[model samples]
Target: MSNITNQSLSEILESINSKKISSLELTQAYIKNIENAKKLNAFVTTTFDQALENAKKFDNKPNNDQLLSGIPLAVKDLFCTENVKTTAGSNILNNFVPSYESTVTKNLWNNGAFLLGKLNCDEFAMGSSNETSFFGNVINPVGDHLVPGGSSGGSSSALAADLTPATIGTDTGGSIRQPASFTGTVGLKPTYGLCSRWGIVAFASSLDQAGPMTKTVNDCSIMLEAMSGFDEKDSTSINKKKESYSKNLKDNIKGLKIGIPKEYRVDNMPKEIDELWEKGKKILKDLGAQLIDISLPHTKYALPTYYIVAPAEASSNLARYDGVRYGYRSQKGKDLIEMYENTRSEGFGDEVKRRILIGTYVLSSGYYDAYYLKAQKVRQLIKKDFDDSFTKVDAILTPSTPSSAFKIGEKTNDPVSMYLNDIFTVPVNLAGLPALSLPAGLDKQGYPLGLQLIGKALDEQKILNIGYAFEKNCGYKNEIKKWWS
Candidate 1:
């Protein structure tokens, strides 16, 4: 039964559908694994009893028509789960459980998937490493001292550790892809408007999008089908018909053109990452994908532009947590104004406060045009760079990160160095396009390295298929041992 946990989500669903295993058995197996892997600190809240009850209910009334029938999935805490503690990895929302469900989770449940629990994340999804999480850092299952990639670290850690078959995570910048790269898994950031953001806690609203992180490319397509749809409540939602990404998946990218951006070869990048990118090009070439050397001149401006825009949005979105409504409050305040100041001062973590200050400064009347407004213009250029490249290619290829996962405390003191971790990933978010990261190889330290495929907006199916083709031919394997359990 414990071995059942090692199977991919698709295989688990097949076992359930074939009647070889019941939902209860699968749920129980995951519970045991979660119980044993406490040191990973991946889960912020465990709904084991609730999960078990849901599993029983699912087993008795199974529906084969549902995409994820009886599948128990864990999601990043950024989502507002009804009656479950929905902390956005910050003390401010530590006790704020939504009475109503988020539109994305509601869709999953409606399609027959139930919650396993809420996983941890960066405070307000701001940090590059899970260290910013108020609950504490989530250890990467790949190595004991390594930091799982941030924002969605807990989601990646759990999925890689097999605590959940597959999980959903929010990506603002590189949250989903970077961690997926570090942990030897598949993570996708869909086109910005493709998934609704109504129920998720706001990070950088315009940049934040929900995506699936899974063990396989196939599982990613299946999980994504269940999680994405148009919602009236979300102003940014795209009103396109739902896509059967899994059913239509094929690796027939024989003549598809993939762009290899010259600007992505950043200074001081690890040789292994460079090698992995080269290997990715060769693999695609062997699969008959035409590799075109392209240039994205605005790539150099992406990181700085992202830093300005994301924080500007963060400052505005996080102003609601002033202790006046819900969430943490400071009882020591003598007046209303003092209370408001005290609550925020006490509620947010250092990284959250840092971003809030940066956001506030950039959006201030005196500097708005100098910083925030200019960044928006640069963002347009970044999008245009992608659009220009897409005119000649179907997708773009790059290394997912500059290097493999680093130690937990290695770059915490230097914010600039920490920010560089997202250099390869931030541009995709800035452009509002879809991108997928898959493990391509391992570094000298035996840590996994990844390659990214960038697709045009609403072109998720093409990248997923390209990734699926790469996954089958690339020989990359998850060599991570279950050391925590």
Candidate 2:
């Protein structure tokens, strides 16, 4: 309770229920934190006054009775927030405020969750480094001049900087986990179709999933409870009975099997990360969980598979913004096609345009079978790697990122190198599995590296149960990441 700025959703709910803090006061505190931490560049737009008004309605609602009641959170700019400027960190939608709210955001609000503002992110959720954002790059709160990763970098940075207790982010290919790894916070990418995709600005429909970024596992569970559900508006939204994400929190992992894919230890991992991975293995082993050396042969092909599949889907999803719709439109043009080229050329960032071109090229008539179809087959093989491994193990354990937070401009110039950062994470997306990034240990530079745990599809609660059990037994304090020093 030192600053209350970084209070978790559960903490806020408990405090509100006890009358130690009111919902309106919590809203004000979060807004003040956002305003004070402007240097973090975590938020693109804030709706403080609007949020304060909403909190008034929750003044007397019992916290235990109302899900997420009195809890304040932020939305990634990629989500359409009604009446709030939903710029996806791109000039393309700079002036576009949505007339409708995204299903995920609306779901959170419907659960009595208070919205703080719109967090910054990569333009169109297209890049690994938030530097692609038109608004500006987000600085890592834990390390000076080090980027907070992307395309959910803003949400992670905001949580790390204590700007917001919880936030929503989309992951197509490790966007959520990589940033969470960089920022030293808990990030969960639940099973695809768990969270509705309606009104979420499309990156890749097949891989796009909305999840929570929080200070701890429990907070993430609470946020997930509020954000996930079935929605007819989103055809992909699974019509499954939603269970309490926190239900399995106290479950013990005494006999659970953890898989270590030797293939995930890439050819050039930093020594510190390798050591950290070994240390993590020892900790889990000592805690009574058995570790097995599982081989995922297709691990090396994850990046190539993700690149083709993500962009191919991206091309189709992004075609809606043809300057004839809601995004930017060129004022002077000879014809419609020229107008689209000029407007899009001026609107999208280098990384986004590059992906679009790559996506379009791979999915084109001549190369569709050679590129897109082949990538799909590779994707199936990657999925099989997990499926086959599950026969031997319950969950897969690996490094969330090959390295910790790199310097701001380090990999921005090389998209291929940047994409490889998701080597250990992409297959999870390709297979539509549930994944989580937990704080592991600090690296050589004092930056934090997180442990990744991926569970079978729709088994997110089990992963949470494992993380919860580990936290209980690992003797891990909620220490601030080393970069803070």
Candidate 3:
């Protein structure tokens, strides 16, 4: 493997800016790594030719002023790229191509980053593990048989494996943070509306937020700065002044208050995770931050509320892929009504169909008040829990996941068990807050464990700063051997 593949996104960009390495050299190195990492199944589509062309274009007329100058970033398949085959890791959209680019990717490109490829993800971003991806499960680079967490598993896996210098993923209830925890990488779920949803494949409209998955917190800040901004095209986008997250990043968190939520200590959580949490608290304390024991009373309701609210939005969002549009069609059906039924039945994977059914059920006439409406009420309570907590603290510290990465099929047979993996992460999404998962330590089995730093809405800068400081002191380095090749 080329040594260029080992450099962080910041390091590589610095080399590019100093003219020590051309953009073409950087892109080619990543392409070689991706080619050798096919066993990981991280990429659903590879656009090497276009990437090469773009790199050459950058080398010819380099723009050093751009934040992501000449960078090649692989993104979750959920983000639609102009004229690219964006499947969202589902057979339904296997042939779907978008004429326009997603606002997030457009932002990256505008800032001088070009597409390396589209990454595999859970079918319509539905499952907790990448096993539900129609393309194939993305294997964690940390271990051979371990499943990469999802629905942003491919983004996490590819990044951990160095298939891409940096990547982006959509978090709809722990998708980004859980996968990063599993892969021993950095992943951020930014505040809802911080990144636009326009042109991304929707799993759940209300909860889906695009954020960076990278090798380090600094790279995360750089990517986040480049990708986030207000988009008039997306009604949910926050129209705020563009913040310089990278420039503002500082390790001097002298008097900041970090909440150690008591509710995060769930029953049966592994001792290592608890130890990791303690380790994080100590790091913050040593860095001169105050740690407080806080209560998010509505934390337990987050999972059920997310399950109801997400699927309800999913069922409504996924209604467009009925074969009459630009995706997979069922030739088996003879008539229009039969076509819609057969198309959805044949097109969507098991997980996607399951969510669609669950969503449809909850949103149905008689059950709306009983399920969906009640979930919305509970969702507010969950948000209120965070809102109340933030009044007492600037940030919250918790374990990113209840456990480390599991074997590919360990939880596949039991969907409920798989869903439980996101227990520590789902609350952030339910509250629509920003959270960053940083690899803090290793478990007894040598798998990576993570600690989460969550901030108030649009307070991503604070958590990123805290994370940068924790990262400096944690002494956690991912020593993943390249066994995949």
Candidate 4:
């Protein structure tokens, strides 16, 4: 058989439905690719045996009508997969296996999608660089030492390396978009509540959202449609009919008003990012999009406010793993209190602990009103900024990250610098809007740089349309040489 691993998700699906390729053959190809690309370390656990069994069952009676029947993809370690090890890239949950599946993954399986395995991520999805992952940082396929972005680093890296045709990732303050930006992949963070969060390991309940990270824009739309829906089990899940985003994609942006937020022009941005932004603007303008300069004035405060709010929720949600429940526990503690403290202290990485401390401190009585409350107020202003801009423009455009992928360990010592990677992406999550990162151009070092499209709440179709137009006209490509093989 030909190298099916190099084909796009849509192509693979078409071939499968035509009976030209079986899911079992495609699954085996990906498994072989995963085994050969171990140097990237994109996966936390590889479910090769289970994936083959599932593929064999599907091949027996293929359902061509289903949305994702016989398709294989990887799930980020954050989502709970029944009977599969679902570690949120932390040693605390190294042995954790969910008896129940997360709503997002369950929906995919119901549509006949097979899981390749669990992808790596930052410890509890807290960091911008994948270096914080307890499973070890996922290496960028573009460069030997370059970081693949975080906390969805593994998801992005795997897709870029062709180890998986598509993958799912969570966006908690740019975990999905930033990594997609670095890896030159397409990642969508759907409107908050569009996808159910139940059974997913919580990092920040309010900000965390499950979305697809794929090689192409159409794949993202198809994956999003399959993964999203209402779930009574999750209070935050929106009760509405799922959208057919894939069917709605079109390569036309005639007369669409695209907003260019002035506040996104951060200080000391690299020339390549600025150029890529300009290139994107030119592409949209050429396609008949009316580019309007808009101001999201409160954007400056988004990162600071997000730091306070996300950590606060994370601290609360993570308190469940205090050694009394499932997950890691300290064997050296003599007392209950000591065991709780020791277990967390040893289990969590430095970045996760840092956020937890910041979270706990802000929520404490002495600082609750001063820090956490004020941050909440600022968050509203951030949302209001988007709300005001969207009224005038159909979509907003900006650089996904300040720069392209940097070498691993370059910013591990400086947390602030690492946090800056998500400066352009955090506001969208804070405002609970849908955003996508698509490959736009390559930096001077040949690393891929991405541009983002921000849309109104629950209006993913518009952004996907805009992205599809850009992808067709932009001529940007994401292929990389197989250095890890």
Candidate 5:
């Protein structure tokens, strides 16, 4: 592997600014890395020509004031990149290219970051594993046959494999953080509405939020600062001034109150996961941060509530992908209705179809009150639970996942088993909070284990500070061999 692949995002930017490496040279090195890493299936579409062109353009300008000047990164295919194909990992929009770019991607570009390509994800961002992608499952860089958790699997895989310095991912129920945990990378799911959703393909509008995946918490803070702002185009976009999160990442945690929710203690969890949780608590306690035992009494119902609410929103949002306007259309359909039916049946993967069906069923007339309505109420209660808890604590600490990354095909046959992977993560989304996953240590199999730091809405800087303190003391190194190379 080239030495360039080992550099952090900030290091790369510094190298570019100091004339140690030209933008074109660095971009070409990453393009070469992506070319050699095809076996990982991390990229759905490679934009080498455009990336090189942009690199050359930035090289000509040489602006030191730009935030991410000459930086090479990848965006998850869920984000529209103006003329680049945004697949969302489903055949339904296999050839769909947007005339406009998502606000998040545009923000990165405006700050002088150029794209390497579009990363793969779950079909309509539906699956916990990247297996639901029409392209293929993204293989974890740590182990040959292990799965990189999804629907942002490709983003996480690319970051871990060093194909890109950093990448963007969307987290709807652990899509970003889970994959980051699996791959031993850092990922953040910013508070809902912190980053605008305009032009990104929506899975569940209420739950989906864009965040950065990188090698360190500092990179996450910088990227989150760059990507977040108010956008009048997106109704849910928060109308708050952009925060200098990177500047505020102090590693001071003394006297900060951290909450440990008792409901997170699920049964049959791996002993290693429990041990890691205890280890994380000790690390925080030793730093003089108070750890209080708290109860999120409604946590047990989070998964079920998410299933109903997310699918209902997904069913509504995805209804526009019929054979009429754009995307993949069916040639076998005889008439309009049949065209709609056949188009969806042929284009959607089984997991996406399943969610759409469940969504539709829950939103149906008679069952609406019983399922979707009830789930919405439960969702509010979940949010309220966090609201009540946050009054007593500054942040919450939990395990990112129930266990380490499983093999690619380990739980494919059991949908419920797959759903349980996001058990610890779902509640954060339910409450529209900011949460981050950082490498804590290696598991017994030498794969990475993650510790999650969740904060109240828009309190990303606090959790990031805590994560930085933990990272400094944890001594967790995310070094992997050039297996893909």
Candidate 6:
């Protein structure tokens, strides 16, 4: 039997179909990887026993060509799993297990994908690094104790460290892409409403869309095929007819209209990231793609706007965490108000508290119109920037981050530095566009950096195709990430 550790999902499934391997054996391989790579802290909770039992069922049953059938996947803890403790990397939900499964999870399970575990994440999907989790920091596994970008940090770390072949992550402001850049993997945040947000815990309702994170673009394409589509439960979910992402996987990039966002090359961007961007453009040009200059002039306002809008919405959405309901409750409080305050104070991590404070402040009565309303107008302007840019370019490209992953504690004391991690990705969320981050090159510290492709709204497939094509051209596939070992 082939060792499942190094095998792709498609390869594993093909082996399973031919009786060369059993689902039990395949699941065991990943379970073993999880045990061996314990230092990375990729998962919040595991379900090996449940997975083994399911694999046993698959062994006795029929085999089919389901895309993810028998393939092991770790979901970000943000998604609700029936009866699983989905902490969402927060102590607030430490003992809170959802009685109902999320729509995205149901879709994966229904498609025959195997669940190895629920991975760790930033608290409420708020932070850029996984350090905010109550579960502790997710070590880069790539080398130094660098940050694994978040709130999908565990998802990308799992894939990069070979703990899982693929996993799903939600991106509000580069949660998927930034992590992918940090870990050197392929992560896609589908266009707004392309993937059903139903059942996935919401951070910013309009901005959050779940997508796949995988080691390769092909793996990304395979997983994405199952991750998307419409759901009635989520009113924002688009009812698009599903298409085969693999069909466009091999599309030629010749004459492809790749746009370079002139505004994203902010003066503050590190020179190394600029070099990586240059390399990406050269690779595309070498592949016969014509690079066009595009402008998203409102890009400068994305950070401030996202901070105001997301927090205002989050402050309102997170109000459900009151002590009376689920999550941690304060047993010592004499009154309801005290209970709420005490519980929240103790349950949430520092970052989560900071965001909640910011959110609350923005949404507070006197501040709403000044911060929230103005942010809304800026949000529209950011969206308009993309709308205007698309008229000149087929797809826009930019460095996924200002720089590569930073040391674990380097940015912790400086909240501004931590927030800057999402600088490049924030605009996409503000506009609710599809953006994919793929490993491009390495930085001076030898950490992997990434290049991003922002496609038209509801046009996730094109972004993937562009990433797949560029990945082939750049040929840096595992070079930057392989240093982790």
**Residues 1-485, model 1: lDDT tens digits:** 54899999999999999988999999999999999989999999999899999999988888878999899999999999999999999899888989989999998898888999999999989987899999999999989999999889999999999999999999999999999999999999999998899989998998999999999999999989999999999999999999999999999999999999999998888778888898999999999999999999999999999989998899999999989789999997889999999999999998889989999999998999999999999999999999899999999999999989999999999998999999999999998999999999999989998999999999999999999999999999897798876
- As a TM-score, model 2 comes out at 0.96
Mark the regions of model 1 whose C-alpha exceeds 4 Å error after superposition. Answer: none
**Residue 481 of model 2, lDDT score:** 44
List the global CA lDDT of all models. 0.93, 0.84, 0.93, 0.92, 0.92, 0.84
The digit string of per-residue lDDT tens for model 3 on 1-485 reads 34987889999989999999999999998999999999999999999999999999999999999999999989999999999999999998999889999999999999999999999999988888899988988889988899889989999999989889999999998999999999889999999999999999988888999999999999999999999999999999999999999999999999999999999999998889899889999999999999999999988889989889999999999999989868999998788999999999999988888889999999998999999999999989888989999999999999999999999889988888989988888989888899999999999999998999999999999999999999999998888899978
Evaluate residue 123 in candidate 5 and report its C-alpha lDDT on the 0 to 100 scale: 92
TM-scores across all candidates? Answer: 0.99, 0.96, 0.99, 0.99, 0.99, 0.97
Write the residue-wise lDDT of candidate 4 on 1-485 in tens digits.
67898877888888999999899999999999999999999999999999999999999987889889898889899999999999999999999988999999999999889889999999999888789989998999999899999999999899999999999999989999999999989999999999999988999999999999988889989899999999999999899987899998998889999999998888999987889999999999999999999999999899999999999999999899897779999897889999999999999999999999999999999899999999999999999999999899999999999999998889999988888889999999999999999999998788999999999999999999999999999898777999778
Number of colliding residue pairs in model 4: 0
Which number leads on lDDT?
1
Q: How much RMSD separates candidate 1 from the native structure?
A: 0.8
Question: How do the residues 1-485 of candidate 5 rate in per-residue lDDT, one tens digit apiece?
Answer: 24877888888878888988999999988888888999999999999999899889888988877779888888899999989898999899998988999999999988989889999999988988899999999999998898999999999999999899999999999999999999999999999999999998999999999999999888898899889999999999999878898888899899999999998888998889889999999999999999999999999899999999999999999999997888999998678999899999999999999999999999998999999999999999999999999999999999999999999999999999999999999999989999999999888899999989999999999999999899988989887887876
Question: What does the lDDT come to for candidate 3?
Answer: 0.93
Candidate 4 local lDDT, residue 104 = 94
Least accurate stretch of 10 residues (summed lDDT) in model 1? 266-275
Residue clash pairs of candidate 2: none
How well does model 2 score by local distance difference test? 0.84
